[model samples]
Target: MPGQENMTDVTVIRGNVYERLSHVIDPEIGRSVTDLGMIVAIDVAPSHSTEGVRAPGRFDVTVHVELTVPGCPLTQTIQDRIDEAVASYPGLELVPHIEVGAMDADKLTGLVSSLKAERRENPFNKPGIKTRIFAIASGKGGVGKSSVSANLAATFSALGYDTAAIDADIYGFSLPGLFGVHSQPTNLNGMLMPVTAWGVKLISIGMFAGADRAILWRGPRLQRSLEQFLSDVWWGQPDVLLLDLAPGTGDMAISVAQALPNAELVVVTTPQPSASDVAVRSGLVALQVPLKVRGVVENMSYFDHAGERLRIFGEGGGTRVSDRLTDALGYDVPLLASLPLEPDIREVGESGRPAVLDSDGSLADTPLASSFTALARRLIG
Candidate 1:
């Protein structure tokens, strides 16, 4: 019965290893390693002392993994995940030896083909998609729309939600600069992996420079670029997706509505009649399209100076836009947030990080972060 018991033990251990690995998700693909055909083989063997005696309750596990891409930037992350999963096995001392390599041409081709087939067309446009699509738009420029989008996205990510953002403003793209993402997305067999910055997955034309940037702007229509961003890029399934649309009432908002039928529009405006006047027009696009006007955000509503909340940009602009849009659209378009005119929003943001996020990437404990967190929760609800 000793031989049979030994076989049984090994079988149970192998099964347990597989179970642990099932929870290890690929950072980019958002699928388990087991599901992605990454786990080529799992070999479990009992450990032996130098004297050739079997060590009880101890084993050596060799996992042969074939990554989808060669020399993936996140290879170390995957390795760390696998190591943790193996080393933390319950009630046993297991040493993991991971054998990492890239999928060969044929294997990679099959994987990509399978993934593309499963993805089909734009995944977000499909019915019953769980992703909450928020298109952040503003009637005019300099309203900190991009800044709001970046901070909101960062807040969502810090709050433990999977978040992604698209800089839908192709001509005046600023997300790449705000998030401080300088590297282009990894192109794997025509599929682009969004650059992860400030805990948010982001894609923007600004990520491309020189000729590539020019090419995106040259011949294709605005709608076409938006379509490519939706269809061509692999977004996986983020809990929230924010699109920082170009300022002014333009085709981008309409394009978003046409492309993403489930998108909700959040208008950004300063606390002044001039900005709020146009901000109302941005939300009014909901009438032209079937999109819903989510709410309004008043950026730079005040400046905190010497125990006084100074109305630097005036007031009631967000309320005015909200009331106007609510009256026009026949729904409650409440003002979601009134962000302050904090200098860090621009200075620190220009340094390539969301001002709402502290250096550690967590939401800061400032009033700004608190307002954004509340705004994020409200939008989700």
Candidate 2:
């Protein structure tokens, strides 16, 4: 019985074992066990005390884990890893029983929200400089938030303004792919450096995600990942910092509200009245965060079919949202820009270039560029 320990001693040792489990990293997110809040409970048999350990210590330990979804694909892996970790502990002779349970989506979202709220201060607000933070947001998915942000960043930099863009859509990140870059940010003394393209600095989790593999990403991890993007990135003090936020009033948007207090909210929407209606809600949600509603940019507003308007998505959406913002946001948020149904805007975005930089094309005559330039001046002033 070289390793046998007393019953009371074994119980005390189980408590120590639980504390050690905090060091295990979640395979998917690379965060230590404690951040996940995975451990639901711990049980040690009666008779426990580090100082009161007698000979012949009983061997017993149990660990409970809460999963985010049912039939968690990594259940076996997590169990085995925990078992191994426990086995390696000295004076612990038995593998602790691992209890697995799933947490509902709402509970997961709350945990993620709290994770983001923990980092309320703007980590990049360095001393002695002026920087404007702009969060490009939308009322719904597919409103072109990422595309608009990329063009704005590139356009700003092309005009000699030092600019950076953070892909704040942690789960639906589309910035890195938009730039045609596949490299991950390197950690330099813990500060991650952003990938540079078109004279604009960029950081995105997309660069770290593998395209061949996908998973159902849930709450706290999403917020923590976005937080890392803000806290760890070597974002230079620039004239402006653009954030490509995920669509809707979700955790990532809330993270923006908590982290970037000085940032202005720029909502993106379409011209359809229905689209405008939903877009208005996004601004209303921003008001909940106490975000200043800057203005709205209507993209793909309409298609010019031989002078007669096609009105594909519907009419007056941008105007509708603009008017609603005046009443709801308590400010006159003008219709900032109306990008007509120009394929070149999509082409440039797909090609990792902003439409504003497309020369010798119909896009050169489009209304997006002029509006963007004017918007920039208004922002700086």
Candidate 3:
């Protein structure tokens, strides 16, 4: 009986090991063999059960590494990694087996495409994970969009909600500095863990790259990189995942649409007519993805003059954009709140502190804080 149970345990462990091993990427296909469904079988038996070579506690594992295409060059890379991962487990020994298989090139490519599609589907709606996806976008830049995204994510953490933010701005990545985090993402069997900052979880190109450097990439290259970001990172299902979207509609936005079809959108804009008009375009662009625009936050709605309103950029831009979105989208787009222009807003972002946290006294009544808190409540609920 003891021997029988041990055999069952070994079999289970073999499957788990294979699952873990699948996370490893093949250099050629840019995807893991597991996602490709190239893993065929797993077998495990106590080394001692064999006629010779008795290692009592140790079990031997053999994993079938099937190639999607015949004569694939990266076969050995996959085998070596599987061998290493299985060997790391105590009470186990690994044996690698490589098999050559063939799928028509078109079928192989289709498999890769479907794997990418499955990931962007609502993981929240799926049974396995509790990750919430949030896309933060602005009508234009210089309206504190990135700063608000970083701080709101940080604030959610202070309130005890596990939060994460992604800088989807491809070319204009500013997330690393906003959180003051610096480090290349650590790769575990090819899966990278998200970096933590101020109690919030984050992923940004800035972490993997330099701020002063220009990322010169063609559309295909950009797609591949963003695609890898979603598939390769182990996000671990936080309460929410925020994205700092770039200022206009282009390839990056379309990629996000393809990947996170269920993603919710939050639009940010300043309280200026021209800004509002431009910001409206962002909402319209999101409509192309058909993403639901939850609400609107008016940044720099005004410059608070102590107890008086210093109507700097004029009022109602938030309301205007909200009304326009509601009309165009045929629903109520509540102008959530307005953020008063404050000099400290800049300082906090540069210092890696959110204005909502570093500033004192009734910030709730302040334009920016008011909008941020209200938006947070709406999105989270």
Ranking by TM-score: 1, 3, 2
Compute the lDDT of residue 309 as modeled in candidate 2.
63
Q: Between candidates 1 and 3, which one is better according to TM-score?
A: 1
Model 2 Cα lDDT, one tens digit per residue, 1-381: 653554446556767777778888654334566677888787765333588763244455678888755665456877888888777877545547888887767777675555445434355544544888889989888777787888777768777887888888766788776766766665433445577766677887677747435635557776777678777665645688899988888877777777676778888998777677788888887667858888888877777777786777876778888888898767688877776676766777687667777643222445677766766777666
C-alpha TM-score for every candidate: 0.93, 0.63, 0.64
- List where candidate 1 sits over 4 angstroms from the true fold: 1-7, 49-54, 209-220
Candidate numbers, best lDDT first, in rank order: 1, 2, 3
Writing each residue's lDDT as its tens digit, candidate 3 over 1-381 gives: 756887787778877787777777654444676776777677776666456866756776767666665655445767677677777765555544444565666765676466445655334446556666778788778777888788678667666677777788878888888777876665433455567667676677787746468888757787676667776665556788888888877677776777776677778888879888888888887667868787788877776575887878887888888999999998777877677688877876788767666433123344566566766776788
Q: How accurate locally is residue 332 in candidate 3, as Cα lDDT from 0 to 100?
A: 78
Residue 49, candidate 3: alpha-carbon lDDT:
47
Task: Give the Cα-based TM-score of candidate 1 against the true structure.
Answer: 0.93
lDDT of each: 0.90, 0.72, 0.71
Q: How many steric clashes between backbone atoms does each model show?
A: 0, 9, 6
Single out the weakest 10-residue window by summed lDDT for candidate 2. Answer: 358-367
**For model 1, which pairs clash?**
none
Residues 190-209 of candidate 1: C-alpha lDDT, one tens digit per residue: 88888999889999988875
